[model samples]
Target: MKLYYHPLSGHSHRARLFLNLIGAQHELVEVDLMAGAHKKPEFLALNPFGQVPVLDDNGTVVTDSNAILVYVAKKLKLTDWLPDDPVASAAVQKWLSVAAGQIAYGPAAARLITVFGAGFKPEEVITRAHAVLAVIEAQLSGGSFMVAASPTVADVALYSYIARAPEGNVDLQAYPNVRAWLARIEALPGFVEFRKTPVGLAA
Candidate 1:
């Protein structure tokens, strides 16, 4: 399997994290996003959407980060990371939606402003980040993870942006449960980190 990705993208990191957590052997193909490589024709053949983190398993391609996670989990039969039962599977799906929705517009958008010079309003996105964190903080109060005692693709989907929320100036200090959850995921075996941008490194 080959994962075509940009290093700074949280979506890319999501797929990479799950692959490592499950011990899936794969190659990382870095796309030069800063140079418009993702929008180029050759890369677009892999994903017409021109997105980072497109997974090519031999000839079968998977687009979207969360979709990649689901593909890998189902392909490997890693039921613990992605459960088989309907209720538990639904629970995992719920958080994956949150990861793509609130987590994207919230913390992820906020960070895009700082790290990528995105035009989103800083105050607005930061506020959105805190709002979602509050709910996540509440959800985690009852359990170690978003779905169950063990980490799942739900956890992987949410981990990258939330872990780096401070880069967007969205303080994690207010969310202790959220902080603890991040630590727990980091402590897991075969965990890979989402790369942090350096100060003044916006491109």
Candidate 2:
């Protein structure tokens, strides 16, 4: 399997993290987003949306970060990462929605502003980040992982951006439970660090 990705992208990191956590053997193909490589004809053939983190599992192609997670977990029959039970599946799906929705516009968008010079309003996205973090804080107060006692795809979906929320100037100090949960995820074997942005540089 080959993962086409950009190092600074949290979405890319999310997919890459899961692969490593599961001990999957894969190759990384870095896409030069700065050089407009993702928009070129060769890359577009893989994903019309022209996005990074496209997974090529031999002949199978998976687009979108969350979709990649689902594809991998189901293909590997990893029920711990993606539950088979209906109610548990729904619970996991709920957080996956949050990862794509609130987490995207909230913390991720705010970080894009600082790291990529994106056009979102700082105050708006930063406020949104805090609001979502508060809910996650409350939810995690009762458990170590989201949706269950063990980690799930939902945890991987939410991990990257929340772990680096401070890069967006969104404070994590207020959410103790959330911080501890982050630590738990970090301590897991086979964990990989999401590349951090330099103090005065944008990747």
| TM-scores of all candidate predictions against the true structure | 0.97, 0.97
Q: Which parts of model 1 are misplaced by more than 4 Å?
A: 200-203
lDDT of 1 by residue, 64-146 (tens): 99999999999988999999999999999999999999999999999998888999998898889889999999999999999
The alpha-carbon RMSD values of the candidates against the true structure, listed in the order shown, are: 1.9, 1.8
Give me candidate 1's TM-score against the actual structure.
0.97
Give one digit per residue, the lDDT tens place, for model 2 in 91-202: 9999999999999999999899988999999999999999999999999988999999999999999999999898898889999999999999999988999999853223
Task: Count clashes in each candidate, considering only residues at least 3 apart in sequence or on different chains.
Answer: 0, 0
In model 2, residue pairs whose N, Cα or C atoms come closer than 3 Å (at least 3 residues apart or on different chains), thus clashing, are none
Instruction: Show where candidate 2 strays beyond 4 Å.
Output: 199-203
Error of 2 at 128 (Å): 0.5
Query: Candidate 2: deviation at residue 120, Å?
Result: 0.6
Per-residue lDDT value at 193 in model 2: 97
